[model samples]
Target: MCSNVIRRMNEQQLIDGCKRNDRLAQKELYDKYSRKMMGVCMRYVNDRETARDILQEGFVKLFTNVDSYLQEGPFEAWMRKVFVNSALEYLRKMDILKEAVSLDQAPEASSSFHSVLTELSAQELLTMVQELPAGFRTVFNLFAIEGYSHKEIGEMLGITESTSRSQYTRARQLLQKRIGKIL
Candidate 1:
């Protein structure tokens, strides 16, 4: 059959092919998910270069760890976890995920912040997030965007849950201030 007539493979097939070291399968997997995964990497990092580096590293980890995939969960979710972990690892190695001073404050989860978010394009919002200090950015991405609990974030970053909450609060305040200026 012609290439165009070949049936498209499912995620498992792709994973299996990758496990067998099939270059075409690996390339196909990369082509399908690189953009989305790049967005994940970029969210944690400040610049494009670092994001690209993290993306490459994440893919390498993905390929090497392909055999560990349990097939019990959504493959994309699994892939996303790998990328997020990779980004976190990069931050830790660079010492960007620092011990944040507890602000002893809570995020103002008000309609104002929501209104600002609604007004901004996704890219604009992402830019605002990227401008935050490294610790704030990491906590914000984990708690706000990724739906990770503060406890989970604390475990991931080796901080206390209270510290995670404090960082998240500070991140929201910074974002609100930046958005206020943008508005």
Candidate 2:
């Protein structure tokens, strides 16, 4: 409990220093959050190189908009929002997000689709998500993982709510199939 307070104080100091444009604080902040944020980026993007680019761009946005922070919530949450938005923006620019759903793919197998997923580790799950098609992956991460509603994801990705739902369904089916193969 004592360490929690110290860590909170340290985080506050880092936020304050970053708000003032302190270079050391900025570096420290980047060093602290880069790896986790890169994981977030990688969930949306396929390759580490693209994820790194998104991470860098997200940090730039985070620092530039530091003055707008109001301490209404945890700084880490705000930073995460920034990184997620950056990744979505990058996906949009690359024209990788498709709203159209493919009807040709096989129908979902069964409700036990995700049962096999529990056997795999987090890193294995991440790898599985990375293997998904871009549209399905984005919807999956946003809805299934990040807890975003279909409406919110639709708005974020500039697609209809139905499209988001369809993509998410398709993503789950594909994951189920893949995990079955592994098991």
Candidate 3:
């Protein structure tokens, strides 16, 4: 298919350039993937400043590990996995991400992220989330935004599932307050 051909060509160029340690190629790759990857970082980090730090760290890992990326499949998925691992690692360092999140029959997400979220600019949404306190925001973003199960959040954060759920509950409350203020 024409799409496959285009993807192959783009990846091939970037892969070859990466193999040669070309800084420009590295920058180009970062430019292309940073936004999505930052979204990953933000899910695990409660602070926008810390999220940016994690984003930068993830890009460094991507650039250095570019050679390790498999040539056979979807590049974005691979990049996402890398960013996710990096975000988890960052949470581990912070010690707060270890709280257990409880799912306990929470309601279904209010809306599909793609549809409900389209109404707000990315910055506005991020700002709304960033307003949440640290522990609450991290759990909320991981569960609500990134679609991680509460059990998964619990394992990642070193907390009980119930705690993750509680944090998520609190996060929702906080977001509601912030949204009300904005309105």
Q: Largest TM-score belongs to which candidate? A: 1
Cα deviation at 1, candidate 3, in Å, is 22
- Sorted on lDDT, highest at the top, how do the candidates line up? 1, 2, 3
Candidate 1 residue lDDT tens string, 1-183? 576455387667888999999998999899889999999999998899999999999999999999999988999999999999999999989997884535454335544767667878989889989988889999999998899999999999999999898788889887887787776
Superposition-based RMSD of candidate 3 using all C-alpha atoms, in angstroms:
6.1
Tens digit of per-residue lDDT, candidate 2, span 31-143: 78998999899899889999999999999999989988899998888898899999999988998787444667645666674557667899888989998888899999999
- Residue 102 shift from truth in candidate 1, angstroms: 9.8
Q: What value does the lDDT take at residue 18 in candidate 3?
A: 73
Count of clashing pairs, candidate 1: 0
Q: Can you rank all candidates by TM-score, best first?
A: 1, 2, 3
- Runs in model 3 deviating more than 4 A are 1-9, 39-49, 67-73, 98-120
* Model 1 regions more than 4 Å off: 1-4, 99-111
Candidate 3 lDDT over 20-39, as tens digits, reads 88877776677677877877
TM-score for each prediction?
0.90, 0.90, 0.68
